[model samples]
Target: MSEFRKCARTAEAAMRSVFPATPLQLNAHLSARFDADIWLKREDLTPVRSYKLRGAFNAMRKLRVSAPDQTIFVCASAGNHAQGVAYMCKHFDVQGVIFMPVTTPQQKIFKTQVFGGDNVEIRLVGDYFDDTLAAAQTYCSEAGAAFLSPFDDEDVIEGQASVAVEISNQLGSAPDHIILPVGGGGLSAGVRSFFGHSTHYTLVEPEGGMSLAAALETGAPVSLAHVDGFVDGAAVARIGDKTFARLSDMNLSDVLAASEDRICATMLEMLNVEGIVLEPAGALAVDALVDVADQIRGKTVVCVTSGGNFDFERLPEVKERAQRYSGVKKYFILRMPQRPGALRDFLETLGPEDDIARFEYLKKSARNFGSVLIGIETSSPQNFEALFRRIEQAGMTYTDITNDETLGQFVL
Candidate 1:
């Protein structure tokens, strides 16, 4: 076996002493839907509700041995990695100084603090993640402390390979295919290192943040001009340098981009149908299953449900995105005649299955005409066709703003 593979096997063994292997169970619902043997590598069940702890544990353990007198560790993360590192710091009885953006949710900050107890100190450094990272790096340099790169370090990648090791052991061999959600490429690169080309891997990235795809396209890691933060867990602007080197040989056929809206729909489906609550990034692999549904039929496949750290407060937003993606809801601006019976006539145009979700009046364009912003939800997408027809027949000029991202952001 290669040195990396041997080290990964050793890391897997060490992990068993710290925490049990996350379950790899066949998912009946997904299996039935996709006509495949769909297994879930339930990383969501980890102590940090993510596979992040495995890497953190492995890296920290190796460090503890290599430098017996080293007691300080530092990391910068807005979510899962912070919790993972902090938890391991507590386990190793080392001082940890974690840096996070000032805008990080209080819930996350509290969770990290709780996991580390008194072993970790959290510093809210800057408003943006970039600034926070810079602050953390400077602190590490000035204090002469060990800095943990969430996904880019050699030791970290070896640690993350433990996931693949566990999967292989649990299944008795590598499965026919494995699907993983990609962020900075740590997990994908690590899993690839252990499994090699024996098992096919489908790497899914958030459509708004396809850093891996960008790297593969350019033959190197490049910073994205824009990144959507909706899928915060996977919204990396650039693929990690070390990670890219490991993943540069990936097949184009194995790469995919999952939309934020589709991910929300998958999250809702898993929660309502399977009682699985997945954060947006966690649902990426499952959502991409649609793109490969026909190809994987009758094959044994594994989808790494990356994390269950979903904030319930975003439920409404998730529902809205899902509704829009499913075409069951819409937003439009109607030019209503400014008269006594105009409102009544407009209401009469709505279909039976349609219900007004939002209504607001804009400035009157003319003394006889006013603009009305309307949000409508329906039981079926087909209902919109009939509803739009009625509005047109009523001699009303309307603009569909549901898919108009700029107006939707500002007005809706």
Candidate 2:
């Protein structure tokens, strides 16, 4: 067996002691929708609700075998990686210090603690992941502890490769194509290495944080100047250095950048229609299929649903993005005449399905007119066309600010 395959086997063996293998179930909803055999390698169903635990367990197991005397492990993360390390610390009965950004969700922090139990210590270090990572590394060096990277280590990559191994074995054949979400690139690198030209591959990443694409462009890993952190699970500012080394040869054509709003639509669909709650990163593979329609149709495809550690508190934001992506919701600044009953006249023009989501009057900018911030939602995208036409016919002046990031951030 190749060294990579050997490591994957070890990872698979280690996982069996903790939990049964995550199911590789064929999804009927997506299958019928795409006219292709759609299978989900449900990493979301793993013990930590992500594939992260595989890497954590494999890396820790190898460390214990090689260094026998080392008992301390440290890592930094805001979500899945923290939970993964915490769980592994409990299993291996080793001391672990996990540092996370203070801005991480309480739900994630709580779960990491729960997984580690008495074996792990949680530290709130910084407001950003990069800062948290630096602190953890420093602490590890000072304490002479082994610092575990979330995705940069060879052992971690080998551990992640086990997912593809299971997919291949469970399906009884190689898939025609595999759609994977790339964050730090561990899962994608490991999976791609295992497949090794046997199966075609597509890498999906968030548009606001295109780490894999950036790595491909630079011929090496590079940190993004700015990244949108909405897809928290996959919104990495840079691909891991080790992972990029393996993925450096990938062509730009194979990578797809999914808009944050477009991704939210997939998240909501899986939740409401498929009864699946996927974190934004978990939805990346599925969302990218829309961008590669011709390549995936009529073929057996597996889209790795990477994680399901979605906090319910973000539901409102998810819903808003989904609505905006579908064009059934819009926020606009309306120049309203200050005449009495003018609001009534505008209301009269809305379609039966149209509902007012928000209405706020801004400071008077002109003598006879007021800047009214209005948010309207309807049952379908077509409703917006009719609504906009009605507003124009009524002689109401308005500017659609639905897609305006700067304006929406401040006003909406």
TM-score of each: 0.98, 0.97
Error of 2 at 159 (Å): 0.3
Which candidate leads the pack in TM-score?
1
What candidate 2 gets wrong by more than 4 Å, as runs, is 362-366
- Predicted candidate 1 versus true structure: per-residue lDDT over 330-368, tens digit per residue: 999999889888889989998889999999995555588
Residues 1-412, model 2: lDDT tens digits:
6788777877887789987888888999988888889999899998899999999988999999999999999999989999999999999999999999999888889999999999999999988777998999899889999988889999999999989989988998779999999999999999988888889999999999998898788788888999998888889988998999888888899999999999999999999888988999999999987777788889999999999999998899999999899898999988878888988989998999999999997555457888788999999989988998998888888999999989877987
Sum up the clashes in candidate 1: 0
Task: State the displacement of the C-alpha of residue 189, model 2, in Å, after optimal TM-score superposition.
Answer: 0.8
Please report, in order, the local distance difference test score of every candidate based on alpha carbons.
0.93, 0.91
Query: What TM-score quantifies how close candidate 1 is to the native fold?
Result: 0.98
Alpha-carbon shift of residue 310 in model 1 (angstroms): 0.8
Q: Output the TM-score of candidate 2.
A: 0.97
Best by lDDT: 1
